[model samples]
Target: MINFNRFFSSLPLLLATLAVQYDEGKTESNAERLLKFGNSLLAQGQLAEALTQFNSAVDNDPKNYMAYYKRATVYLALGKSKAALPDLKMTMKLKPDFTSAFIHHGNILLKIGKMDEAAKDYQEALRQDPNNQEAKTNFESIPALKEHIIDAGQFVKENRLTEAVDYYSRVVMYMPWNVTFRALRAEVYMKEGSYYKAIDDYKSITKLKPDSMAEYLQMSKLHYALGDLEDALSDVRECLKLDQDHKQCLPHYKKLKKLDKQYSQAQEFINGGRYEEAIQKYTKTLDTEPDVPLYKMRSKAKICHCYRKLHKTVEAFKICNEVLEHDEENVDVLLDRGETYLIDEMYDKAIEDFRKADEIENTQRTEEALNRAQKLHKQSLKRDYYKILGVKRNARKKEILKAYRKLAQQWHPDKHEEGPAKDKASKMFMDIAAAKEVLSDPDKRQMFDQGEDPLDPEEQQKRQQWGQPFGGGFNPFGSGGGFKFHFP
Candidate 1:
């Protein structure tokens, strides 16, 4: 009966102890459950939710190494690589030989562009567990990094530049020490027409390797395309500084210099309204690069226009003629010369030039010249008909007609109004009628062709007096009614 009280008291104490142990076990299980949930979320890319679960697990068991490691992974997933650093270090301290933790820590350092620290972490991971695949892969990846870079180069060549950029970005992210990735990415950026992005990448490359001409040329070309001519000029000059006779860069440098000067002069001339003088300046620009066909053609056209405005037709014609002599098929010069000929009223010459001009295909000036020449030729023919008609040396056809009509009407004096002028008019009229008849006849027209003037009264009288009677001896309308005038 004395041992019952001691037994009861011990029973209660034992029950309490068991309850406390059970509670401790429950707490640890709940913490493990939270950690597992967090890891699942992380693997599924639900980083924020995983972070919440990881934070709960860490709160439940502050010393849980896996919780720390999982929380660090979530941080990395969330792009908070710096935030993951201390958690990784804590994970390593909690479990020193944790191979996966070493890999995660190194990877976080790598994400933050810290290659040396990341390499150390990877090495330590490999040493702790020599057969760890993740550690081995990360370690082996460093030496084969350039091969990855060359793969990216091949991607660029294939014009899979977006994918190439991804590969290059990976190299840049994993091996921040090697700048070739950045440089390669810059080149791809240029190909993609992302000039500003290329400039930024090129700037990084220049910082890494100061003596690279390729970077400078890329930057210059980009600047030029963007119309930042001054910056383009600066970059080209810097490129030349790297290699004085760099063949690729020399042409660009020369082009930029020429463009700069032309832009300045053009602005100046436009503001001054000195168009003719400006044209002259532009003409002089062709001297810098005469082999450029566009420059020569433009200069010739402008100079020709200046001559035209100054009313210097001959000068314009001369220049166009010279150009045509060299390039007979040059449509612009041919059209221009045709117009000049029309302006000079050389209508036949203008028509010929215009016909040649029209034979040139598909030009505005050719059409214009053709139309102008046709119009002027029609007008010229109408204005100057005398050259085609061939009238006489000096005789008035009206005076010749009047004298012949009076002689024919008076020879029959019964129809004539008469006085002392009547007999004279009749005899003179007969001679005049014979003269007019001979001149008008076609056979006498042949006689006139032999240099005889049939309109001369004296020649007509000689022919009448010498005319022979061929069929019969008969009196005709002559000086006497019984006397016949005959000639051999």
Candidate 2:
């Protein structure tokens, strides 16, 4: 009763009819038998065996929509959605009214974020089966999602990345499983200078695509940019696990490992109060990796901080300026430089820096530093040895001696008559001598620079008890506590 040769002659047009006739207990084609076997294997969770049967079924009858659809389902079960895409498309082509095929296709498209195309598939599924709840729910949600995606795109085009991130965030919230939208939002967060948030998204993406090395590599770079060297190293280690010899990852891993060790050693030095050693270590880090701007800024800021701790004002100022040239708002560098200025007795400069730092970030530390600097600056103006000698604060011993000699001779009491004129002359002479005494001695000069006048009555008593000379025991004409100006 079955015309076998006629069925073979009209394979494409009669394949479905032939399979359906087999279902009615007539002569069955090999494809129908294989399709049945594949379904049985699929239901038993034997995806590989089912895949083999489905492949044979498709080979026997290329026009079998059910075979293609079954193969696509097997591929989905095996977590091979990409492999299922072509089979899903073929099923749709052979059976345009297949509601399940359209729903499956739309789901894959939605997962991969082909929003408009996914919407069309859902619409077709709804058209075929108006009562399909899944299709109705998905189709109804697409228009609002599409509008959010469109708004995000427009904001990105206009460089309004904050608004773009906001819309992208909304999309991600609606479709948390959509990696594409999450990645898009991550990129916008990066462009908006939200590196930590970008890293958070990338971390989620790694969960979605655990075998993907690119996401780990990107996360490593973000951590490195944010100066989280240890975190950067950890992410790179994840990348290595995914791909042992990844070109960029291996070298980055090595570099980060080296930096971590070096940085930790530098921190140890800092904690131990070995500031010079810390500075050296920090400088080595900078020299070893000067390519990354953020890394360089961090390293140099630390070096500046070390110099501040060492009371090496010149070196601190040099490194601090280098850091500020790149990052003027760097609060750590500003604080370090302010302290450096305070140590160098540049009170006005210290006050200015402290005020600027407080303006940038109003914190208790900065406010206290500002108050201290202001108080010290006001005290500094009261008694300035440099002003008394009419010389700069950084005047060398030779310059200070020269200025003192000139002023002392000009204001000698013997040169003036007794009484008011002589008393004035005596006071001027004593002040000039005290300035010279402090400025000429390195120890006293250091003490004065630190805001403690060695010539103060209290300080002088301490020094006297310690057997140190008062005012270097100035005896111009050679003996006694009296001043005798020789005609030179």
Candidate 3:
């Protein structure tokens, strides 16, 4: 009554079940069965099932460290590191020389960024079983820690402070004793705006190693940023003592000394209510450091303050003028000079300086030296063109023209009867012609009034032609006459 095809399919399952039961009953251990099942499941890529079977084997034979190790391997294959870690740890605890378990633990740590711990585990595994290929291979494989340190350096060079800090932290974790690495990381921290973090790192560096000039300098810079000038000065002195010619220390030392002296002198003068004396000392301080633009500006300012205190308007004006000579666009100098002029009842000069100062780009201290002579020229002042021609200023137009003609005729080099006077006469004739043209034209006269030179080359040529003597009575205006006189 059985369906033959169905029966055959069921028959194989039944036989397999019977055989497993027979094997279990024949004094063959459950541990062996669990081990076999685990192997079979593992071969089929059923990691979770294999893990269960191996775990069962371990439970059945707690003394069998191999079962625990195999179970851990399955757990690892399943990507269950938490489960795998504890099991591997236990395997190693059971078999203290379990190199494979230690290596696996290190690998898991590496995956999670616990590089230092991972490295320690790997090193311990290597010590326990130097010839264990898996341990040896893994120990070498955990990323080159030194390379990470170098990567931190590269980040610093590229001005990537945040990235450098991260890489440096990694290096420090693996190499806590590396004082140089700690110091370098601190520098990156400073650049990244974490000054407190930087200080901490610097302190760590000093603690881990002997004191050095570099550490002192770093501390000084931090103190300077924090406005603890006394502490900064102390560190700077220490740095200088260690390396007297250190270029970095020299600038700070000079600056602090100058500031200290200025402060003391200023206080003394100020307490006595001698503002003029205080200003003088400040000015002297500035002169000692001329290359410092700030010093120049401060000195100039102090000079003005001194003059104000002494109520010496003339001296104040002179000082402002000197300031202008040095800085042609100093707004303070310009304003001060303008005020000085106003006090002296020179309104026009004051206005000129004020206008020039307004045109300058405003800054700390600049000069505004107005051309006083040019500014004094009246707008309506007419140029005496006739006088330029050696005629009376009020001479009639006809008389002016006549005077110019006479002068041109007499000085024409082409008609010069003699020597060195010929060159001089040519120049004089050119001048006479130019003056006549400017006087004759109303527009040119106006231009001359505005201080512009107005001379037409054509007028000079025409005068020269007219002035030339007739050679053998030949007229240049008429053709076919004796050789024409060509004025040079």
Compare the candidates by lDDT and give the number of the best one: 2
lDDT of 3 by residue, 350-396 (tens): 66877777677543322223433233233214334555576643345
Per-residue CA lDDT of model 1 for 1-488, tens digit only, reads 57988888667545644554465556657678777666666776668877988898889998998888888877877756678889999999999998888898887666444666778889998888888887788777765655667788899889998988888887887755356667778878878888899898886676656687888888898887775879989988988998989998999899879967975785477467665676667667677646655446555665665555454688888767766666788666666666666556676786677777678674676666676567656645432211212222122446545554544554544555778667765655455544544444556544443334444455556666889212122222644323232222
Clashes of 1: 6
What are the runs in model 3 whose C-alpha is more than 4 Å off?
1-122, 125-148, 169-177, 186-204, 218-229, 240-255, 287-488
Tens-digit lDDT track of model 2 for 159-191 = 999889989887786577678888999998889
**CA lDDT scores, all candidates in order:** 0.68, 0.84, 0.67
Worst 10 residues of 3 by lDDT: 468-477
In angstroms, the error of model 2 at 265 is 1.3
In model 2, where do residues sit more than 4 Å from their true spots?
A: 1-109, 112-134, 140-175, 184-194, 383-488
Candidate 1 TM-score over all chains jointly: 0.34
Query: Which candidate comes out best when scored by TM-score?
Result: 2
Candidate 2 weakest lDDT stretch, 10 residues: 473-482
Quick one: ranking by TM-score, best first?
Answer: 2, 1, 3
Model 1 residue runs over 4 Å out of place are 1-30, 110-116, 140-173, 176-197, 200-488
lDDT score at residue 202, model 3, on the 0-100 scale: 71
